[model samples]
Target: MSKKGFAGFDPEGLERAAEAVRELSQSPHAQSVIQLQIRQQEAKSEEAKALQKERELKKITHDHEERRKTLQKNLEINKETADYNDKLERKRHTDKLKLQDEFQEQQRKKQEESIKREEKLKRETMEHQLKIEEKRLLIKGKVDAEMYRKNHDLHKQELLMREAERRETYKQIFQLNFNQLSLGFEYLMNNPSFMYKFFLYTASITTAFYFSRHSIQLGKNILFLRIETNLQKKLYIFLGSRYLESVIGKPSLIRETSKLSYKQFYKFPLKFYKQVTQNEQILKKNIFQNIILAPELKDNLQIISHALINKKKHQAPLRNLLFYGPPGTGKTLFAQQLAHSSGLDFAIMTGSDIAPLGSQGVHELNKVFDWANKSSNGILLFIDEADAFFRKRENWNSIEKSYGRSRYKLT
Candidate 1:
């Protein structure tokens, strides 16, 4: 009825779906419906026209009731077609609204899922951070505890060691004092009832020691028991005779004696006597002790001791060794005693003495070595903690070489 001759609410639908839909509107099936609808509409229009024509005809010639009945039927058919079109339009609108509702529901569900995912991620992140923080705190606490424990242990060990050291020091001092007292007592007891003679001998010794300490070199001359025993006996006899003269008016049997009778008598060499006495005491005091294996070593010590004491030997050993070990094992004292007993003319140096010497010190060292070499081939030169200066020379830098200096020509 319109442009394409189709009967529908939307004639444009046929053109939009397919070009052939226009032809379908002209097909026998759709055309039949269209023709019916068109016929109905045309009938209504024709019926109106007919009714008017009939009115005029009736006015001209009587008989228009049949034509009015026909007009009413055609109007009824037009109303039926209008009702069907209205139903089709309502169905299309309902379907479109249902599709829109479904889409909105899907969008809302998607948004909810997104929100849930974001919240979950936030929770997980917070939990992870909390765990890490806890672990960090735990590790820090452990480290602190371990450090405290170690420091406590170290402090305890230091306290015990200090206590032990103090006790040992007091013990050594007591032993030394005891030994000196015993020696003094034995000296008093051995003098055979000659009180004045003993007193004089003690006085001479006391005076000699006093002068020696004050460094009156000439007055400091002191003697040990190294002379013959028979000669010492005669000197004691002469002393007894003098005391008897003062007390008993010189026994008549007493006579003039040879000057040789007054030479100092020695029961045994001071070296052997002192050594035996020292060994017995050392064994009694120290639970553990060190021993040198060479019998010749003791003789060597004795020879050197006498020579130095009497100024009979001025030369010193050119080669020496310093034995190093743990504390209470006797390092310094052993060296001092060996020097004293052996009578070696020697100098002692410690690690602390290496500094303080100026740049010319190296030359002085050379002179010292040369002089010692001239002094004697047996001269011993030893420095404790020599490893400080004699480090490995791999770097070869000036500072390192200078500070860590060592001379290997120590023959």
Candidate 2:
């Protein structure tokens, strides 16, 4: 059976060619046309060969009878007879193999001969087609060699074009992301509040800051840091220098990173002290180095790097900030790390602590900044859980945390 090749026109072409031969039969070219018809049939020669093999197999097995017969023959018998029969059977099989090989060789030669014959006949057929058109118009057929070949080539080109478009789109996306990161870092330096309000995350207290300046010393920057009043809480900083090579960046190529100053690293009572640390040593040991911080600190640093060639830069302010976050996400602990990273003078004035000392504390506020001014470039004031002081007294306990959280949307 012939597999459908031109979808709907291959079998039709075979019929018309057959009709062409019939028409030739009515003319003086009948015998030669018949020979040409034989050449045209090469397309189905495989099917004919299969059928011929089936017939040959049947003839060879005819004397073998039913294959299901038992080995318990009446001649289970005479060794001499069995040996002789076995030799005869082997000889027959050898002969059959040789015949099959010869037959396949003949078919191969015949197919090649038919191909050349068709090439010659094709030229004659083209000439006939031209003659028919000269006399009268001959209707064009569905399948044409030139058109079919061109269609296949065109389909390949379309696939390649689509693949190119896909690659271009991916490249465009990568360029966009690279530009966004640049804008984000610049925006952060100019408006630290923008990052704290939007992309805020749990990080060391030492990481949250702005440009700091002392009363006398003008040019030096004093990074502000908020100190968590509670002692012994562990804080970790993450300085992720992600490379823009792929969606997952490499740390080695980072050119810069920023975090809060460590000025407050040792401030605050032991009862309120929390350890602030960033684990770069551990990450350097791993195959994939993505610097992730321990939860609790107020802000994480941004790392910019190139993976291909190693380069790095690190920066962060060691100054002031307002502590805010969800109840259990470690808002207070981060405030202390801010002072530690900056190595600055620190003070703790919570809402309640300052509430009673109000007007008198207002006077002390001047002295507080004066002392801070004389000692360090920055100061950390941890006003943790100060929502109580900010919210209405009656609403403080009865009010849902949602209302307090809404007013203080730090993250």
Candidate 3:
């Protein structure tokens, strides 16, 4: 190598480097070192690339975890909202069912009340119709009775006219015969024997008439002539007290004795007559419907009613019932109902009247019992204030004295 100074390079160093490169290039160790260095660089580059790839993978994993947590939270919130809405819907449905049940209950109650009112109205209407029918029947009966009386009177007048005509014809014939026999009658009157015979015949005829009249009077008093007498008129005439006569439902066949105070005699008879003549079912319905009593009492009364009806049907003797109670306790009403139920004729009498009667009390009581005995269907004698009449025998004398004192005072 030549030594050169100024060539814009280090001449000495370049000449030494060129000589070293020529020597190294000719050595195999130099080629091995270069190959090793190149391999090391390539390995470091590969390591750096691998580290970058690992960091990118870690970041991707973290992002994925965060996204999963957010999705879970949103899902949880949506589920809670859905659960709350479902609970609210269930509560609303329950409330709707409750309201519906209440409405149905109210409607049912209204319908029941309406039904009860309708039944009450229908019952009242039936009762009204029954009353109207009863009144109409009563009027019709009165009209029929009046018509019968008028027809009977007209027939009696016609019979009297015919009898008068027959009598006139007989009288005219007798007069003609008397004219023809006038001379003979005068001659017979002059004869003593003929006069005696005529007087005897007259006496006999008069005696027979007197006896017949007395017999008839006795027969009437004993009620043996089957004559329809005006007992009410006779009683009124004798007693001199006002005797009221009110025509009840139907005309009675048998004449009844006069009642003292309340004339429930006619009223009860009318009811009994209706029971016999009208529909029995309707009559019983009317009676029981009008009566209000305890369940047990009503049941017992029904039993008695059935038994009494049975006895009446069999024509058996009926039992007497004594009702003891305070005033206005429905005793009289119950007795009337029982009589009507049993289809028996009832007569009401007051014991106060018996006390006033004095000596005639026993006779009147006997008369009542006798009358009851004669009844075909049986009679229920309802005596009000029975304590007044029923007393010890010793008390009767005092009652009689009191009655006498009253009579004296009245006189």
Candidate 4:
């Protein structure tokens, strides 16, 4: 047996079968059966193709579903990560804001403390100053009380002395003989004829006095005496014909400077004349030695002396100078020394003299200047107590004060 060949038939069988098939082919039924077999084979082939197509479609669907599930998982993971990052950022912001709030609170507290300290210090300082002022006022009050007590005691003593003197004066007046004077007064009052004669005699005497005063005044004018009063005329005549030279000499002006005497001029001429007749060098040295001045003042005096000497030598107009200070400061002495050193004539006048002259003060001052101008050597006219005239008058108005102030500068 040949392994049942391709269609499960032996060779003999196969041959036999083929013989049958040839025989059948010779018949009409055989052809019909062969055609029906071909039809059935085609149907089977179509069924197999349909089953394969169904399997391929199922596999594609399964693959697509797996890919979709993986993509959904990835999306869920990304969402969770974003949520965590947002939470972390929110926490950091919260912490930063909290820190800022705490810092501001601390700064506010410190500022309040600083303000409190400053207020306390200011209050303390004011209190201390007030205490110091109170103490000073207390001390001043004590000192004033002490001075008042001393002044009261002194005033009491002065009152007691004045009372004693008044009592003594009253006693002396009572002791004097007034009986005869009283009787004579009574008799004069009782006698009408005597009273009439007495009245006539008084009238005549009054008339004579009036006329005599006028006559004397007229005589003075005619004689060109230029004296303002009888006392002044007598004094002028007694002094000399040379109005400036006789009784008015240089050393008469000297005294204890603090207690300067208006009468010192009367005792100066012989002594001054004697000094003037001395050698020039001796006189200059004596003046320089007598003055007690500061080194700087001495230098200034030397400089002024040289200047005046040069001015006199050149015959130039002399410049006026001022020397002002408290009494006893050697202003007069300095002036005398300066005049002698500069070889200029010294003419001293007290402002007190001019003050009594009233309207004649200006005229008298002009006369002094005229006398000074006649000197061959320049004159240093020293007017002591010049403030007497230079002082502003209380009665002056604004215009007068201004005009007087300017005019006084020439003095």
Using lDDT, give the best candidate's number: 3
Predicted structure 3, TM vs. truth: 0.33
Between candidates 1 and 2, which one is better according to TM-score?
Answer: 1
Tens digits of per-residue lDDT, candidate 2, 305-390, equal: 11211221233333334545576654544434333443433455545443444346455455444434444235455555566457
Alpha-carbon RMSD to native, per candidate = 35.2, 44.6, 26.5, 27.2
Q: Put down candidate 1 lDDT per residue, 103-202, tens digits, no spaces.
A: 9999999999999999999999999999999999999999989998979988899999988986886688668767876876687687556656766775
Question: Against the hidden true structure, what lDDT does model 3 obtain?
Answer: 0.68
Q: Candidate 3 regions off by >4 Å?
A: 1-277, 314-316, 401-411
Residues 13-117 of candidate 4 have per-residue lDDT tens digits of 778899988998898888788888778777777777777777777777877887787788877888888888889889989998899989998988899898889
Point out the higher-scoring one by lDDT: 2 or 4. Answer: 4
Model 2: how far residue 151 lies from native, Å: 44
TM, every model: 0.22, 0.21, 0.33, 0.31
TM-score for predicted model 1 compared with the true structure: 0.22
Cα miss at 137, model 3 (Å)? 50
Ranking by lDDT: 3, 4, 1, 2
| Candidate 2 RMSD computed on C-alpha atoms after optimal superposition onto the true structure | 44.6
How far residue 1's Cα lies from its native spot in candidate 3, in Å, is 99
What overall lDDT goes with each candidate model? 0.54, 0.48, 0.68, 0.65
**How does residue 310 of candidate 4 score in lDDT?**
61
lDDT (tens digit, per residue) of candidate 3 on 1-411: 556566655478777789988887898798887788788998988998888889888888988998899999999999999999999999999999999999999999999999999999999999999999999999999999999887997889999998898677668756655664676578777898987886687566555544543454464456533356577755544332111111211112223332211223324434443344454554454456666777997788777776777784676666777777688867777777667666676777777678776677786676566555656666777888888878998898888788789889999
- Candidate 2 at residue 204, lDDT? 40
Report the Cα lDDT for candidate 1: 0.54
The TM-score of predicted model 2 comes to 0.21
